[model samples]
Target: MDFYVAFNKTLNRFDLKAIDLARKTDLSMQRVSQFKDGFNVRVDTLQKLLEVMPQEAKRYMLTLVAEGETDSPPSTGG
Candidate 1:
């Protein structure tokens, strides 16, 4: 399953609206909207969103992050 799909599913599970979540997490409304619209989110922004999620949903989101990190190419230092 796509990470964004999983994210939205977790949000739905908690009956959370994007606007409310953005406000609660102290993130910009545009940022949350962009995430809901499937724009790739930065790690720090994702962390902020996860921090506000319920424990169950947070665990699922972290699992997705771990999986994604495994799938990414390793960075080459300059």
Candidate 2:
């Protein structure tokens, strides 16, 4: 399973949208869409996401990504 795909599910479970992430994080819709499209965002964007999530959730997200490391990197990471 793709990390971003799984991550998108997390966002969906919370009823979040790229537009909402963009608004709260002051990021462009394009950028947030890139994320939801299973793209690897800049490290800085992760920083913005970190700001919006609780520490526990952030830790879980990091763990989720790490668990997928051996699976594959997002195409956008290339």
Candidate 3:
């Protein structure tokens, strides 16, 4: 699954909203909304978001990302 897809699932599972995440992470609500809409964010910003997430949610998201990486075909040298 894509990062945004995993994020959305986590939010749904935890009954969280963008505003809730913004308040918890001290990030702008717009940034959270953008992330939910599939925009990329800085690594530190992502870390802050994860820091505020429930442990289970964090694990779920990580698992999704790992699974997605594993599902991709290996790259070959040109």
Candidate 4:
């Protein structure tokens, strides 16, 4: 799955919106939405998002990275 798809799923799983995430990450809502829409996000932005996200979100993000490295990403419920 795409990073944005997983990201959106994480939000959905946690009952969070882009605006809420933006507020928590100290970013603009536009930036958060951009991530959801698959825009290229900066490392700092990614870091900020992860820092503020729930453990499930962080785990999902790790899963995405690990899958990318292994060329066989897992498909699991967010």
Cα error, candidate 4, residue 41 (Å): 0.9
Candidate 4 clashing pairs? none
User: What alpha-carbon RMSD in Å does predicted model 4 have with respect to the real structure?
Assistant: 5.6
Query: What TM-score does each of the candidates earn?
Result: 0.70, 0.64, 0.81, 0.74
Please estimate how well model 4 matches the true structure, expressed as its whole-model Cα lDDT.
0.77
- lDDT, model 2, position 67: 65
Per-prediction tally of clashes: 0, 0, 0, 0
* Selected candidate, larger TM-score, 1 vs 4: 4
> How would the candidate models be sorted by TM-score, starting from the highest?
3, 4, 1, 2
Clashes of 1: 0
Q: Which is superior by lDDT, 2 or 4?
A: 4
Pairs that clash in candidate 1? none
After the best TM-score superposition of candidate 3, give how far the Cα of residue 7 lies from its true spot, in angstroms.
0.3
C-alpha root-mean-square deviation, candidate 2: 7.5
Off by over 4 Å in 4: 68-78
Worst 10 residues of 2 by lDDT: 69-78
Select the stronger candidate by lDDT from 1 and 4.
Answer: 4
lDDT per residue (tens digit) for residues 45-67 in model 2: 96896678656655656665666
Over 4 Å off, model 1 = 63-78
Give each model's whole-structure lDDT. 0.75, 0.69, 0.83, 0.77
Compose the digit string of candidate 4's lDDT tens values, residues 1-78. Answer: 566777777777678677877999889999988989999899899888888888877796667655753234465858
